[model samples]
Structures are given as C-alpha cells and as structure tokens.
Target: MSKFKPEPFISCYGGALGAGVDEVGRGPLAGDVVAAAVILDPAAPIAGLADSKKLTERKRELLFVEIQAKALAFCIARASVAEIDRINILQASLLAMTRAVEGLAIQPEHVWVDGNKIPTWRYPAEAVVKGDSRVAAISAASILAKVTRDRELVLLHQQFPDYGFADHKGYPTAVHLAAIEKHGITPHHRQSFGPVKKRLEQLDLF
Candidate 1:
C-alpha cells in the first residue's frame, strides 16, 4: 500500500472541531466491537501516528498513552457481544464508532470515519477508505481502539485461559480452533460467527 498522505483539514461546521473515528474487532470471533474517536490538538501533534496494524505492540501502546494525554478530545466505546450477534458485526462496528464519537467530552461538528460505510448519525460525517492510515486523527483512533480491544482480550484470558485469548485476540487461529473444538464455545464467542456457529451446531449447543 502507498504511504498514507493526509489531506488538509477541512471542516464546514460552524467553528467546531472534527473527530476521526475508527473501529476494531469486527473480524474477531469473540469480544465486543471496540471503537474510538479522536479530535487531535493541532498544536500538540503526535509523531509516528500511523495505521495501528503497521506499528509494533510496544509502539502502539506508547502512542495510545500519548494520544490519551495529548488529544484535545478522545472517547472509547464498544458494542457488546450480544449486540454484535443481534445486529451483526457490520452494524455493531458502526454502532460502536458512533457511540465513541457521541461519548467524546468535546462535541465535534463533523465526524470522519475510517471505512467505506458511515454509521446512522445526525452528525455531518463522511467515510474515507483507509482513513486510518491516511488521517492522523483516524490513526490515533485506530491505535486506541486496537489497544483497548487487545487489553480486554488479555484480561479475558484470566477467566478462560484455554482459549488463549491473550495470544489470538479472539481471531480464529489454529490454536483457537483447536481449543474451541476441545472445550466448546464460551459466552464470549459470537454465535453468529461462522466458526462459532459451526462448532455450536456440531455440538448441538444451539
């Protein structure tokens, strides 16, 4: 992929700030859909802000702290696993993003979401493909979302060590599949997800 080049900040709202939003955990087999909204402080610009996936865990963690401290406004929110199963992951992810922005301490005039689809919201919002990499605020939101979800998974490992949520982060990896097959699904697993659904059917759990 080409290196991200952010376009100039353009907000048509009446002297209001623009919040960048992004979601993580849409692809996970388990866990809530986490999202973040960040209104960056132009004066406190953070270096090394890029797509969260492009950075190492250590780097991402460092930036996560920096963003929390330096951002003009930031909010982290999530759609529950039950909501993900009921509304589906796409809608759940969007809902999470919307919630993140809505929860921000500072109200924003516009919202820039990192994706092709926009959530149902009254705020002036637009979606940009790969905005997480192209937009600094979106990148910061991505880092916050990713780090928050990863930390949740690590904590979940304490309750269910067999799934190795700390390692796979709820993705359908080989180890995760093996564990699911051997131990069955947990309440955390999304029943709507294919792997979890198939396993539930196999075990006649559903």
Candidate 2:
C-alpha cells in the first residue's frame, strides 16, 4: 500500500481530515503503553506502509522517519505503568490514544481507531477492526507507536540489562519470563498484568 487517499467510504460517519490511531505494548509485561495518531497527506504519498508488526525493525525505522516527514501531522503518546495499574490496560491504552490524537499538530475532524473499541472522547470517532492493516493512516500510526515504544525500551534495557528489554522490548518472551523468574519484578513491570501479578503472588507466598 503506497498512498491512501481519504475517501467518503473510509469515513462514512466521521468528519473530514481523518486521523488514524493505534497503540503498542499492550501485551508487554513492562514499559508504558504507547499510542500514535497520524493524519496522512494526500499530496505526499508514503510507500511501503503496513502494519508495524509485519515490518522489520529496519523497515519500521525507515518508515518512522518518512511518516513524520511526509504525513500531514502525527503524535505519539503513552500511559505509564502506574496508570495501567490504576485504570487497567484497556482504558490506559485508550487514554494514550486519546492523548496522542490531542497532541496532533493538526487537529483531526475524526479519529479512526484501529480496533473494535473507541476511546472516550468528545470528538467524533470510529473503530475499525484490523484497521492497522486496512487503513493507511492507521498503519502509519502503528509504525510510529511501535518504533517509539521499542526505542524507549532499549533505553530502559541499558539501565536493566538483566531483563534483556533491548531484545524483547519487555514482551513476555521466554527469555523475558526467565529473566523475571530470576530477577523478580521491577518498577517498570506492569503490576496489573498477569505474569507480573503472578510473580508478585509467588513472592508473597514466600
């Protein structure tokens, strides 16, 4: 998918100037949930835009820069681990998405979210399932959110190399599970998450 021209079919109920939104790190045991909103520019077409999970790190990095340079406007935002614990992952994810949309350099007429659920917001918004793969602007948002979260996790890795955050980006991979088993939980881990909560339970059992 190269350039996505905003069509009436795409925003059947939304206003003009549609902004796509997506979130990353929802399944991670650590790191804040990151979200991004992007309003693509029809005049400046970006090539090779796809779901960020499908793209290699190199491809994502390349597109991350291109998206920022070519898109009409984009914004990345996050909900902290603490917020996730307080409000739960789903709400925190939406909050981050809402924040991302609000931070846009150009206010969008409507927010096109990449999932079945839309956040609580005053503006008009629509949720399209699998939108990251279907919508160009949503794909751009996925790229930015994923790349930004991964970059931040790498920084956290430097401080806590034992968790191998740089390699797994705080996901619940085998290596990460092993690291958690050995090292226990850190402040960075989302205590509200199952694995982290289970780990805390085992510790309390002792």
lDDT of each: 0.92, 0.91
Error of 2 at 162 (Å): 0.9
lDDT of 2 by residue, 1-206 (tens): 78754343355744448899999988999999999999999889899998899899999999999999998999999999999999999999999999999999899888889999998888688898888887889999999999999999999999999999999999999999999999998899998888888989999941
For model 1, residues 1-206, the per-residue Cα lDDT tens digits are 99556675453543438899999998889999999999998889899999999999999999999999999999999999999999999999999998999999999888889989999889888787888877788999999999999999999999999999999999999999999999999999999999999999999887
What shift in Å separates residue 110 of candidate 1 from its native position after superposition? 1.0
Q: After superposition, how far is residue 50 of candidate 2 from its true place, in Å?
A: 0.5
lDDT of 1: 0.92
Each candidate's TM vs. the true structure? 0.93, 0.91
Model 1 residue 94 CA deviation in Å: 0.8
Query: Which clashing pairs does model 1 show?
Result: none
Output the worst ten-in-a-row residue range by lDDT, candidate 2: 6-15
Clashes found in each candidate (C-alpha, N, C closer than 3 A)? 0, 0
